[model samples]
Target: MLTIWSGLAVGAIYVLVAIGFNIMFVASDTFNFAQPQYLMLGTFVSYTIVVSLGLPLVVALVVGGVVGFAVGVLEDWIAIRPLSGTGVHGELVTTVGWSVIMQGCVLLLWGSAPHRVPGAGSDSVLTLLGGRLSVNDVVLIALAVGLSFGTHYWFTHSKLGIAGLAASEDRQAAMIRGINVNRLSTGACAVAGALLGSLGAVVGPKTFAVFTLGSILVLKAFVALAVGGFGSFKGALIGGFAVGVVEALVGRYLGTEFANLAVFGVLIGVLLLRPQGLFGQRRERVV
Candidate 1:
């Protein structure tokens, strides 16, 4: 039971991280490598607001989200937008550079130490269905599942979402149809950043706010994206949950090191078998 609940918690975090990656990458066709940094930034901001400045949790969360949103827009303008071309080379280089800069900034501000988040509702462990789990774990899992659908709806139903979808299919056609590609791209980035930052703010206190947090999370998210589909919402959710469950089960049976290796290997095999991903649309080749 403990294993099951714990596995669910782990899966939730992966889902959150992977969703952000899917949204940002699919909308703009650019890899926002700095996304993890934004997550860490959100965590750090919340830590500063709540722990250091003695602000309320609500306030800290708001500030953290706002900060993350701004960072996302800035990244799109500076690193991603500039590189909008035939391929993602420009965005890739710029994001790598931005990641370095953000890391450096984090180091300068927070140093190399890990910060803790204060307890939310309750830290008490609850037993359910013969399994012990913390309240935070329950909340995190619920949030992840809820947000998965929420984000899917946001992208598919909303006006902005339709515009984003149009842009994703073809930038030229989207533009010709009066879709503002730039705004859609920027909005997508902002949304991704806010979601990631909010996830960090909620999860960071429990996890640690460290320098390598961004890199590690981003790597995990990248794996999820590949496993799911680079641009598929359902793919990210499914891939992330599977990765988490596999990691947990593997770690329990084997060692932690083998878990990552096993998942990556599976990802490679899956991609080889189905390149379009589990639910991804088939890519049409241009002559």
Candidate 2:
């Protein structure tokens, strides 16, 4: 039971990362590899505000969000916009390089040590249905799940969402129809940035603020994204929880070393069975 809760907590983080990837992908047909780093930056910023400056956590959230938004704008202007061309997905050279650069900057700014951030609500452990879980775990799980469904609903129902869908499918046609694709793209990045920034409050408590957090979380989130299917919010939820549970169960029964192995094993199995992922659209190319 404890293990399951642990998995859910960790998986919630993955879901957040996957959503960030999805937002960028939907907007620009590109995954900001630096997206994960953006969340990592949030954690450090929150840490600085909460610990170094002795400011309230709320202040940290707002500041981190602004910083993240600014960074997202810069990312679009510098790393993504300049290299716009055909076959860009397989060749996101600048974004990948930017991730490395962000990591280096983080190391220089925060050092290589991990810092603990305080959790909200309560510090006591609560037992639910024979499972022991922390307040932060419950908070993260509930928040991630709600956001996933909320996003799914919004994208499926709202006019703006429908427009985003149209834009994602065919930007040129959408532009011809007056969709303002560039604004959509920037808006997606900005929204994702704000979310990650606010999420740092809970995330820092669970994972600790560290320079390598982005790299680690991004890889696992990619696994979730692959398993759940690209462009599907429900997929992100299911895939994230699934990956987390599998990793936890494996670590508990097998060993810590085999946990990652088991998670990747699931990814391979899913792709082998359904290449487009469980919910992704099927595309056919003509030769």
Candidate 3:
């Protein structure tokens, strides 16, 4: 029972990261390898606001999100925009270079040590279904689930969200139809950054503000994305929880070392069996 709760808590973080991936992919059809840097920036920004300045948690989160949003826009402008339509696959390298650069900047600003950020909620533990969980855990889970579903609803119902989707599906067609693809792409990055920032604030208590947090979380989130089927929002939710639960159980029963093995084992198996992933469709190319 404790294991399940723990898995859910961690899984919530993965879900948030995966959603960030989904947003950028949907908008630009380009994976931002530097996406996880937003999470790292958020954690550090929140720590500066809430701990160094002694501000309220809400204010810290807002500031962190704004900073992240700005960085996202900057990323789109500097790293993504000029490379657009170049068909040179330079984005792959550029995004990775940007990620490395962010890491270096963070190390210089925050140092290599991890900093603790206090949780917003009560410290008391709650017993649910015979499982021990804290208020922070509950809040994290709720926020993650709410954001995931809320995003799905937004994409389904909102005009701008729908337009974003249309733009992703066919950028040329969307442009012909008077949709501003560039604006949508930038908006998508901003939204993703905001989400990651707020998520970093919420999960800081558990993971602490560390320069390396982004790398670890992003790797697992990518596993979730691959397992769930890229571009499928619902799949991200399911895959994240699934990876978390399976990892927890494996670690508990087998060993910590085996946990990663099992996770990657599942990934390899899935790829071999269904190359498109669980919810992904195989795209056919004409020769």
Candidate 4:
């Protein structure tokens, strides 16, 4: 039970990284492999503000979000926008390069040591439904679940969100209908970046403010995205929680060495059984 609880908490982080990937991928067909790096940057920025510079946690949160937004915008301008209509799929390689650059910058600036942030609340364990977990875990679970579902509703219901949906469905058609696909793409990146940045304060304590945090998250989040469906927020939520719980169970029963292998196995199984993912839709275009 405790293992399940622990997995849920860790899975929430994956949920966040998954959401970042989905949001950007929604507007830009290019997946920002660097999205997790932005999350890693957020934790370190939060740590620097709170620990090194001795600022308020709130300040760290705000600054991290702003920095993330700037980084996203920069990535779009330098790496994505120029190659937009070239039909070159170069963004794929560029985004991966950007991630390497981000990781390198973090190493140069912060070194490789893992730094702990003060938890948002007391870390004391609480028993609920026969599971011992911390208050922070409960908060994280609520946040991840609520955000994923709420984003789904927003995409289905809200005007701007619907516009984003239109853009995602058919960028050229959306442009014909007066939707600004470029702005939409930039907005997607910025919003995704902001989410990654602001959550750093919350996530840092659990994952630690570490250089390799992005590496830790990127692959698992991609797995969660694939498991849930590439573009579905609801799938992101379900897949993330499933991955976390499964990883925890495997780690406990089999051994830590088998945990990653188990996750990869799950990915393979899902791809074989449902290539479109759990919530993914199959599309056919009329020529």
Candidate 5:
């Protein structure tokens, strides 16, 4: 049970990261390899506000989100917009370069050491279903579930969200229909950055602020995205939780070293069985 709770907390973070990836991919039809850096920067920003500046958690989150949003917009303008209409490989290389630059900046500013921040919730523990869990864990679980469901509903029902989806499905058609593709793309990046920033504050206590954190997170999040099916919001949530739970179980029973092996083994197996992923739809060739 403790393992389950811990896995859920980690899964929540993965879900947020995956969602950010999905948002960016849908809006721009390109993956932002630098997305994980936003998460890293958000954590450091929150630490600066809440720990160094001695501000309230809410303030830290808000500031972090704003900074993240600005960075996201900057990325779209500098890295994405200029490379638009180019092949995916170019964008991928550009984004990866940007991610490396951000990592360097973080190392220079924050140094090589990891910094810890206060938890989002109290240290108190509660028992549920014979499992003892911390308040922070509960909060993480709640936020993960809530945000996942909320995003799904918003995409399905909200006008702007639906427009974003339409734009993603057919950017040319959306443009002909009077939708501003550029604006949508920028807005999607901003939204993704904000979500990642706020999530950093929420999960800071579990994972310390560190420069190298982004690399690990981005890899895990990508795994979740691939497993859940790219572009499927619900799949991100499901894939994240599945990865987290499986990793936790493997680490507990087998060994820490075997955990990653098992996770990737599962991914390989899944890909072999269903290349499109669990919820991902395979695109059919019109030809």
Candidate 6:
């Protein structure tokens, strides 16, 4: 029971990250590898505002989101817009360069040491239906679920959402339809980065949230993306939760170290059987 609940919680986090990837992929048709750096920067920013500057948690959250928004928009302008699906190699290199820059900036600002967020509250465990959990963990899980639903609503119903979808499906058509593809891509990046940043700010203080940790989290998110299918929103959600459950069950019975290996092994198995993913559509290029 504990494993089940806890795994669901972790799965929620992965879902958030995977959706972030999907939003960027769909909007810009490019992978924003610097995304994890945004997460790290957001955490550090939250730490600065909340702990160092003595602001309220609400303020920290807002500030973190804003920082993410700014950075994401900047990256899209300076990096993504220029490349715009020239091919994966150029985008990958650009993203990697941005990642290095962000790492340097973080190191310079925060120094080499890892710092914990102040006042993460008592370690007293909360119980629900015989399942033990931490307050922070519960909050993180709830935020992830809320963001997931919110993203779905925004993408499917809103005006900007439709425009963004159009931009992804056909950039030239979107422009011809007066969709302002550049702005749409930037907006998607901002929203996705803000969500990931906020999630990091909320979760970072409770655990080890150094630069490397942020990088590792993003890698897990990518695995979730691959497992869920690259561009399928539904697949991202399902894959994240599925991976989370598997990890939890493995950790409970086997050990912690093997959890990741097991998750990837399962992902590989799935990909081997279903390359296009459970929800992914096979693309038909119109010549």
Q: List where candidate 2 sits over 4 angstroms from the true fold.
A: 85-87, 284-287
Model 6 lDDT per residue over 1-287, tens place: 89988887777777777888888876667777777777778778878888789888778778888888988888888877788745444867787788788888888888877878753542657999999877777876776667666776877888887777778887888888888888888888888788777766676755544766557767777877788788777788878888889999999899999998999998889889888776777778889
Cα distance off (Å), candidate 3, residue 285? 6.4
Q: TM-scores across all candidates? A: 0.94, 0.95, 0.95, 0.96, 0.96, 0.91
Residue pairs with backbone overlap in model 6: none
lDDT of 5 at 79: 81
**Counting only residues 3 or more apart in sequence or on different chains, how many pairs clash (N, Cα, C under 3 Å) in candidate 1?**
0
lDDT of each: 0.79, 0.85, 0.84, 0.87, 0.84, 0.77
TM-score top scorer: 4
Rate residue 60 of model 4 by lDDT: 83
Top of the candidates by lDDT? 4
**Which candidate model has the greater lDDT, 4 or 6?**
4
Q: What's the C-alpha lDDT at position 140 in model 3? A: 80
Model 2 C-alpha lDDT per residue in residues 39-79, reported as the tens digit of each score = 89999998999999999988988898898888877777777
Name the candidate, 2 or 5, with the larger lDDT value.
Answer: 2
- Tell me the lDDT of model 1 at 55: 84
Candidate 3 clashing pairs, residues 3+ apart or interchain: none
lDDT of 3 by residue, 195-230 (tens): 787667778887888998888887889998899888
